[model samples]
Target: MSRFVVTERAVINAPVEQVWEVISRTDRYAEWVDSAIEVTDHHGIATVGKTYAERNRTLGPLQTRSVWTVTEIDPMKRRVDTGVGFAPLQDVTNIFEFERTKGSDGGTRR
Candidate 1:
């Protein structure tokens, strides 16, 4: 299969630390991620080599469970995870980035 990258961007109206608190919680992905239905087996803290289980729905009635491993993490900067159960793709990596913003409201641009 061809290698490709998919990116999603959003602007959170909160401080960098505030945004990091929510984003760093891997178990809470189901609350914000459109495809994530549930998350389990989270190790509580985010660090290299942590593993978690997630339930995802990609299309109409198409659901999947993937065991994800934390490959890299940079607090308040970036986080990377690789999945093992995503078939046809061989591998999948997800990265989240947080950038501090300077605006009247003074929040974060994620």
Candidate 2:
């Protein structure tokens, strides 16, 4: 087995449903992801079991293409994404977690 270390974590402020709406839209990756990352092959066919073209750079001076799919998805619990684009980052698995709670003022905290 290989050891990998993660350096950053992303926090999106939104409800699980709302977050899913944004994340599940593979066609919108180029819009939300940083410039270093790009998403392609997002045509009419959608959802898991579909291949997505990806290009990533500025990752320790390493760049590669990866084909990814929805893999595992749970509406409110989490979504797991894996890379399969024949890139150095291939086989990469990302766990996107979702949680919500009530605030002191009776408002929701995402």
Candidate 3:
């Protein structure tokens, strides 16, 4: 298969720490993410070396379930890494990063 890089961003009206608190929870993905319909399965803290059991719909009638481990995490910079899918079959790695900038009005620049 071909490998391509993908980037995603979200804007939240909260502080970096505030956003981190919410985003770090793997079980709450269904609340914020569109694909993560349910956290059917998982093990892991919000930090690195944790694993998450997840079930998700990918496209029309396509879905996947697997143990996604926290491969890398940089909470200070709001970055994370997760590995998904059957390793011996198809491997999918997800890297999530957040940039927190300061706005002039003391708001978080998400």
* Candidate number with greatest lDDT: 1
Report the C-alpha displacement of residue 15, candidate 1, in angstroms: 0.6
Q: Model 2 over residues 7-98: C-alpha lDDT tens digits?
A: 44545556556766776777777677663277757643245566677776645777777666667767666666677544444477766666
Candidate 3 lDDT over residue span 1-110, tens digit each = 87767776666667777777777787787788777778865443465777787677766778877667777777745455556674333566776666666664423443
Worst 10 residues of 2 by lDDT: 101-110
Clashing pairs in 1: none
Query: How many Å off is the CA of 37 in candidate 2?
Result: 3.5
TM-score of each: 0.90, 0.69, 0.77
lDDT of every predicted structure (CA atoms): 0.82, 0.61, 0.66
- Any idea how many clashes model 1 has? 0
Tens digits of per-residue lDDT for model 1, 5-80? 9878877888888888887787787888787889967876676898988888866888888888899888988888
lDDT score, candidate 3, position 40 = 69
Residue 24 displacement (Å), model 3: 0.9
